[model samples]
Target: SLGLEKMPFFTDSTMAKVMLLLINTWLGAPYFMVLISGALTNIDGAMYEAAEIDGASRWQQFKEITLPILLLQTSPVLILTFAFNFNNFSAVYLLTGGGPINSEYRYAGSTDILITWVYKLTKEQSQYNIASVISIILFIFIASISSWNFIKSKSFKEDSE
Candidate 1:
């Protein structure tokens, strides 16, 4: 069925590309969830057994052993997931076109992310310079957040070890 909400905000080619990215991300998360579940299964059962022997409750066992191990195994998966969600475009575009409209904002629809907005401006509006500027800003934001996550993961490893 062709719901109005299902339409992309811009029929213009520029916005179409952003919509595709959103779609890809929504599809990608299930794969990540599979990997995460597999990682959880790989955690050693022996540790839990030992914790139980020591009178640690199930919650304590999970908190002390399961979570740490899970975190260690899933850190990279988490990084990938974060990156995916950060740039996720398809889910947004397929559903809303990123707008029902907000004119007060310089270049945004209700659903526009920095990345999608840039795509629209460059492709639809022919505003290459502004698109590039927005792209740079997004790159910086993603890089900084990823770097922080990596650092924190490293610290977590150190403390746990």
Candidate 2:
């Protein structure tokens, strides 16, 4: 049923995926907003004045001055966001119980992420070793992507000194 407005929407898998995506995005965006606001607040007012003297429009100032500085300062926060979202399982588990009804899959629900599926395997099916293996794989994948993004953001190369 998945309890969408006190009605069952889980009968259709497409609706379920859409709902889950919305919920996950809702949970994630606030952290990004708070972080970006803080970074924006810390920028020196002189930079904006200089850009204005050079006849830069608002968009040009943001593109040339603001975003580059914010990206440089907030790289680690972005990395943390990706890492946290990589293993997020509770949102899917709580919403759907990982299923629509009686359907057969090997320890996976339609919405089951790697972390949630591993939890179900070890806790419900007692496949401890295999769950551990899957967890390690998930960790490696997230770590590699996060590291790459972190390094790429370091190329912002603003003169903070």
Candidate 3:
């Protein structure tokens, strides 16, 4: 609610996109924070003590020791977060409902992600066949990404070895 009455109209797709991202991040941060805090607790204190003995500065300790352990331990959660965001429909649907339509794109609004677009096609337009096709495509895309993430996860690799 900036003084829009005083300022010139600045309607842009980028502003809506940025706002959506910020809102989604705000909604998602708490979950990731919990995961990261658990991972942090599990990190070995001996590692930090060794780093301190080696005259490492606080930044150096964080960079060389803390960051790597957190990343390695939480990589799976990161992948899960990516997957969740990829298919996230409720946030976009509830907040914007795929609004501020772009005239150029057929049946698609500027803020519509793939899932919301599919929902619109099915519910509003009665395009069941097209919606089904789009649903299959979305499923394939998510599955591929999830499989790739599992393959790349440290736990999966460790189990294989």
Candidate 4:
């Protein structure tokens, strides 16, 4: 006995994206918090005191000191997190199953990411060649992003200097 009640947040594609993002953030926030907490431990309280003595506002101190130090300390973790999320096959597969299918698309559903699309190509359709190509492209994309992030990290720069 189905009712005509509206639940757009669950049914709508746009809302589904928001829901997935919220879920992802909820899942990832703990790890991010831990990394940031460790970085915060490394920052000297004297630095904040000195900044306050110089008449720096809270926002200014955060922007000039805390943000940079956190970013520097957590850059590697950030990069790894990016890579992990980029290819998060299990989350996509188990939670949504690349669902809310769009009839227009050949194999991919509305929520189907690259990994899921590749899975469909390989498993359902048995198109190994195309799946391999897609996998290669995905690998290249992830690798390039990771490489750029690594190069831009403070540790890399510090080592070079």
Clash counts per candidate, in order, are 6, 0, 0, 0
Q: How high is the CA lDDT of each candidate model?
A: 0.73, 0.81, 0.81, 0.85
Q: After superposition, which runs of candidate 2 have C-alpha atoms over 4 Å from their true positions?
A: 1-7, 101-105, 155-161
Off by over 4 Å in 4: 1-11, 157-161
With a 3 Å backbone cut-off (N, CA, C), the pairs that clash in candidate 4 are: none
Tens-digit lDDT string for candidate 3 (49-76): 9989999999999999888788888887
Q: Cα RMSD (Å) per model?
A: 5.7, 3.8, 3.3, 2.7
Note the residue pairs that clash in candidate 2: none
Tens digit of per-residue lDDT, candidate 2, span 60-141: 9999989888888888887887788767788878887677643676778777778888988988999999899999988889
Model 1 per-residue lDDT tens digits across residues 1-161: 66556555355445654665666666877987887789788877888888888999988987998787778877876886787666767666556556646676666675676766876787778999988887888888888988888888853454543
Candidate 1 wrongly placed segments (more than 4 Å):
1-29, 155-161
The prediction achieving the highest TM-score against the true structure is 4
User: How high is the lDDT of residue 141 in model 4?
Assistant: 94
| Model 1 deviation from native, Cα RMSD in Å | 5.7
Q: Write the per-residue lDDT of candidate 4 for residues 18-70, one digit (tens) a residue.
A: 76788898998898888888889999999999999999999999999999988
- Candidate with better TM-score, 1 vs 4: 4
In model 4, which range of ten residues has the least summed lDDT?
Answer: 7-16
Query: Candidate 1 clash total?
Result: 6
